[model samples]
Target chain A: MSDYSSEDSETEFVLYRNNPEWKDVTPVKQDDGEEPVVAIDYTEAFWQYRREILKGLNKDLNIELDFIHKVILRQSKNYQVWHHRRVLVEWLKDPSKEKYLTELVLAKDAKNYHAWQHRQWVIKTFNLFEGELEYIDSLLLDDVRNNSAWNQRYFVINNTTGFTEEVLNREIDYTLFNTKDVTENESAWNYLRGLLLHDKGGLSKNKKVTEFCENLYKSGNHSPFLLAVLVDMCCEQINEGGGDSVYNLDRARTLCNELITKYDTIRAKYWQYMLDGIEKRPKRARVKRLLRAQIKHMDS
Target chain B: MFTSETMPSLKFVPELHKKYLLFILNGKLPNLESMETNRTVLMYFALAGLDILDEIENIPPERKESIIKWIYSLQVVNEEENISGFLGSTNLITKENRGKNSPYKWAHIANTYSCLLSLLILGDDLSRVNRKAIITSLKTLQLPIGSFKGAKEGVEDDMRFVFCAACICYILDDWSGMDVELMVQFIMKCISYDGGVGQGPELESHSGSTFCAMASLALSDNLHRLTKAQFTGLRRWLLCRFDAGFSGRPNKPIDTCYSFWTGGALKILNAYQFIEDPNNDQFVLMTQDKYGGFSKWVNTVPDPMHTYFGLAGLSLMNISGLNKMFCELNTTRRVHDCLKKIQEKWK
Candidate 1:
């Protein structure tokens, strides 16, 4: 791993710099000398050799930036090339091109994992968070089911500023608006939970969130994600001494039945598990409520 | 996505696939001309695919011996560099430059893993594997954070190589190659709040990486380190991966590979019982090609990697006519039994 201490350091460096030069490649005559080689451009060989060159880099060394960029343009999925590019960019102290390069690569393949990971690195290294939300919006508009875009949105919102109530509420609204028509999008659902969990109090205690969920439920809308969230809120309420059986536990149980029977059959077992938890919650809640009444009576 | 009450009549062409593996072994694979770097992994897929079909006995003894010889020829024999593991193929090595003095003396952990498994599947005695030197090479590849690179050649240190290193260590019946605490720390950092593990810290939870993490933890015997809530959350995340077939992550389309990648993770976590659904079986069957092998999606081209893993998923679900697989080692039960005998000899 320590390349500097090795005896073959010079040869290894030469291997790292041994990328094929396209200008040196030319058509060659056939063995009979009758006609020029039809497809003797050696383009495929050049690219394969270029990949070997990139793969030869050691952690302690560097490579030419132009070679790294060309290799990345040819093979965007080759994360080793991307790592080399990142190392060169940081070594040169010029990270200005990373964002543009990542964008260009993503334009070709939107869900390229290496491109996404590089984008996050570039954003953090250069503090290039401006207009990130708009970028995420564009990605989401193209495909609302893109979890990478949602994860990036979560990163940008949380890292760019403090998670105050105003920011949290705005994020909730943003996610809610996107999920209003499509409740099956796990990206937006996860985003909503991620944002709400950062708040001081949970989602059940928030009036706007509770009303929003109640309105969605009462309007005869049947999104399994929405029902699941509503059930969670109901369970939380029931566990918090909100002992209104009609509104909290009973509604949650009915929704659990709906989830198990009609919606989300893929995860019916999980819903059953949730229902079992709901059943167990009452006994614990009863014990807590009795203890609270006894303490109040003693105080009186 | 089929909504019919009856399951599809899936065909499993064991004979055609066996012939295909033989062709691949004989170097008749024009489509894989440029995949020389991944030759060892491809070989593993082919051999293991046949093993899962219980067709290893169909190969002639001489052919199996030659395959084992080819795999051994790729092992790096450097003592000074201490990187004594198997290279991917002989493409990087020439006859003129084939010793400790050779400049191309390097080994990739992933390739080493494939070579070792293929040898075990071929019933090769563990006499030739330089366990001490391979452990030393593994130590050099491990980062301070416990992640490992595939090779010493500046490759990305991610969960993939970490899993490979863990498997190599497990195969050798040795834990001296890595720092268990640091490895556990790295894996812990990879576990997202959503319960799924990622490739590294702060990355999105992915099913493949989650499997690698789980398998690494299982191999290291440190799965009990997870808190109860974390364990439950992981189970929930894995169980929720099903929506007909398993997807790698939330909102992703179901693919056949995740049937094993995610399914294998669930099996390793001892939570396979919770993943109850007839739809998973139907969806996996839907990806089977009419000729042979399985593809990532229905109606797509079939490949070796997906074919092996698809059979592996069926084996995990106890589908009839398929041999059970050892999920942690990614081998058929027969190969795993051979490995246990080898371990007994070592003891």
Candidate 2:
């Protein structure tokens, strides 16, 4: 039998630790006394250092990926681990498989922030905008309440089509359709509001959106989101000096009162604040208000 | 199961929370293994929680000195490479290579932020901090877009790092660390379609990132960067998140942490008055664990992060027995006053 020295046996079990350069390196201990608040496990410290050494050595990408996969599986929300994965994917220059990994992580926890972030990075970095809308659609179809999917839909459109006039019209219709399905869904309402604001003219300029809100309001839909959108529309008109300023201010105040009394009582103070702003019109708008008051006085 | 009617009488147990934080600081707690890399952050939650609870005196003077020394030990300064920041722990440093710089030993922006705050909470003068080296490192970490990376060559550059960098610059009273104009531009780009800010451009609007962005701007005194319409939209987005307590995103379940993330944002925006206080306070109190800590949700295990944020959320509402927190700096008014005095001295 070949003679095996103890040193060789030690080297076989311990990889980076037994290296000549690392021989003098002893992991620094935290000065926390016994039973420290944040205990530093020296074993973990050693392994962390060892991994850094291996990373410096230009280890195989597959090995690093596998290690990262295991760590992410254990701790999906760890930002550091996700950052490490991004660095590895950048090094590999092949983010083709990253989406699938993010999908796996998201499957375990649908709202995993780190996973969604990684997915966004992969899609953006590789310019993989194709079929992403369909992916978002599938996610929304499964759970229309998934705000992440709604946000992703907005992201994909902004990145791919640049949200041009045509795209804005299409998105407005799309969001309206979803809002019709779930009148109480804040995500859909927020999406519609976002689309309207992104248009060249602000919310008041979007006749289609105003008509949609008017239709919903006339249909006896008192959803707080719907009412809030109407108030926003009125405010936009008043702010832009479009249509009848006095009428829009009155309408906005009424809508705010409705929100405070019945629709969104939880945020009554916000509605009251809106009412105060409407009542305290800016100097330019106040001048318009005084003229209207004089006209009303003359008519009376 | 806790509804308005069924909720227990609201209680602010400062002593219980103080005991819990002290125990965690002096003793070990299980299930925190995942935070091994974020030791400094963990310490911040504990120390800062105690500060908010007005029980910093519980920690003996000798112990405070050791803790300060421990925090200082994690500082990594290499003036030649213009790198200076604090490590989360001494894990990467070794006995023989403790003071010498290595490629693997670099400062993490988040850790550095936590370290400065921790030192302040412990009443350290911050004179031992390497301001020049840290400021230089901060300059290098800034991306062209005005956002910052957590460290050099760090991949996770977003509003979170921007907030950390802002806090560092504000604490050190140094504006040369980052380009404020570029940082403002980056924050503007992060405004999502829904008016809430996201971690980065074109990303989903999240309450946490909204707080980070808003606080960064507030600290830099650049809140004027937001347009009037944008400010209105932001306030609308934040107010709409109230569902008993605030949620990070639309159509999401309410978590205890958003009380700080969302509430703190509103506080900075001067919109805190819009929140329904009783409902929010009840929801937060319902998540308070009887054993002495707060969790993200009801019936979940309590952790240091949520515990600190929970106390912070209460402090924002001026809950009795808790010190008033400076929402922007994530510290008590007393500690922030101390910090302000230090900055005055620097001037």
Candidate 3:
């Protein structure tokens, strides 16, 4: 992607993420006892391989070609990765056979999550599988938090095949989310009944989404985009009411409790979304904390 | 921690800063100190520079709220004559008796585009904008030659009007506003002997005109009429303009705004990738000033148009750590997002 030499330290960081010594610099790490990231060698090979692929000499660089044999695939946790692998299948020499084989091999290993989602994407993209619903009970055990797969489950149930109301209800509870519109409280109330019916579902569905948003705050996704997304879902759970708006506001207050401890300008956009999610009427103390946090953030 | 060095390539930050500030503070272009009421090609660079700097805070809150009021004043919808939108550049001869900010006549295509952009940049939701007035105004601009004249009177009818119309039509999110087939046909006729698009048929192919033509087409989303062969030729003509920066025509000295003009054309054509050269950073940097503003070239005085585009050129190269600024102006995503939101809300 650039002209910098393989030895250039700046260029080295692109591939040096997983190396033990460079751990502080990169968020990437390897599984224990694996080869420490060999950046210079990898970058050299990548450049040479890219040169061959770019100038009409060769097309396939085969970064992941014929490499993984582990049915237990955990390459990336994101749904985007699952989507890309499906796209990558088309660029392969024999797409249908090759991707199908890859899918089967992956699923056979420890019931892979994204690989399962890839199978769903392939099934959905090409319209191949007709009887996929027969296996939803078994597949839901792979990862309960695989919201994408569960999201797809609703799509499959609604679009692909008819599921009994009982099954849909069971699946929603077990899947950690129920497809109730947070926009209207009635939908949230119904969903609460459904979520309580399955697993250790102690809280109502509204409480669960709120708790889920709080748990996400435990991570560093306090950016405005994240809070905006969270509040939107909460608002959607109870559409356009001052009450739901107030409820979301309370949740936002809980989310930003650590403002004096940590918060800055770069993170201010996310804070704005958090405030907006409360329908722009935040707690006075929280407002004070936010102002102090923003001032300190901008000052530094 | 985040600095200009973290961008795709370094241009003159000082030059860029100076040019951008000039763009904001009413640039000193020879005798032209500032535009009073009407918007021009200059405002695109000016507003775009503000976007690049992430400094919407500099814009007064009421600028858009009032500008909307001002644009409304220029609209002559369903009048005695089919007088479309006209730009009121002079405050001297108008109905309103103000020495300041009165778009005192019918609106023009370019002003319509500028006013809308100014609104968007000011972060105003465009709910109050009169799309119909602008669209109805656009309908009256078409001449017999299939090209558009700027206004009903003696204004020049050429590629600039076409670009402005395209931008206006685009900003309104309505292609029904313009005669798309005729516009495409007219643009097709403007293809010069060199396969480059021009202002009108037989005019010399220029970077500014080429951008106007290409952007109009891209905005219209009538790109299928523009064949791949033409795109390839355009791609070639555009890439050849580069000597650190791009020129408007072949063998012409590259100017600063062509970074946007030619670069913007290349961007619309999806051919920006072929021109990304890491070695050319120094050439781009030459346009930069250590204090502020970018010049057209290395040794010139800095201004806003170049400043806006120099940053845009670097953005096309996907410089790391500049993602926030880059994503905001992401042409495809921004348009597509707007379109999707409208569809969902209206659906």
Candidate that would win on DockQ: 2
Ranking by TM-score: 2, 1, 3
DockQ preference between candidates 1 and 2, better one: 2
Model 3 C-alpha lDDT per residue in residues A92-167, reported as the tens digit of each score: 5334543455446445552343454455546655775665554443444553323223334444654444445465
CA RMSD, predictions in order: 7.6, 5.6, 24.9
Q: Supply candidate 3's per-residue lDDT for A287.
A: 71
lDDT of 1 at B189: 85
lDDT of 1 by residue, A1-300 (tens): 101212332454333225465346553321211211111111123222344565585433234665566567777887656887876776668887788888888888777778888888888888899988999899889888888888888778767885688898888888888888887786687678677778676757666676777788888877887887788777767777754544487888899999888987767777888889888888887888899999999999
How well does chain B match by TM-score in each candidate? 0.96, 0.97, 0.80
Every model's DockQ? 0.18, 0.33, 0.01
Judge candidate 1 at residue B128 and give its lDDT: 94
Q: Write the per-residue lDDT of candidate 2 for residues B1-347, one digit (tens) a residue.
A: 34568766777677777888877776765666557768899899999999998888778898899888888888999887766899877666666676789876778899999999999999999999999889988999999988998876554788999999999999999989999999999999999888899999888889999999999999999998899988988988888778878788888899988989998999999998887646568778878988898999989988889999999998887788888978888788999999999888888
- Winner by lDDT: 2
Model 1: CAPRI class: incorrect
- TM-score for all models, in order of appearance: 0.85, 0.90, 0.46
The whole-model C-alpha lDDT of candidate 3 against the native structure comes to 0.51
lDDT of 2 at A3: 17
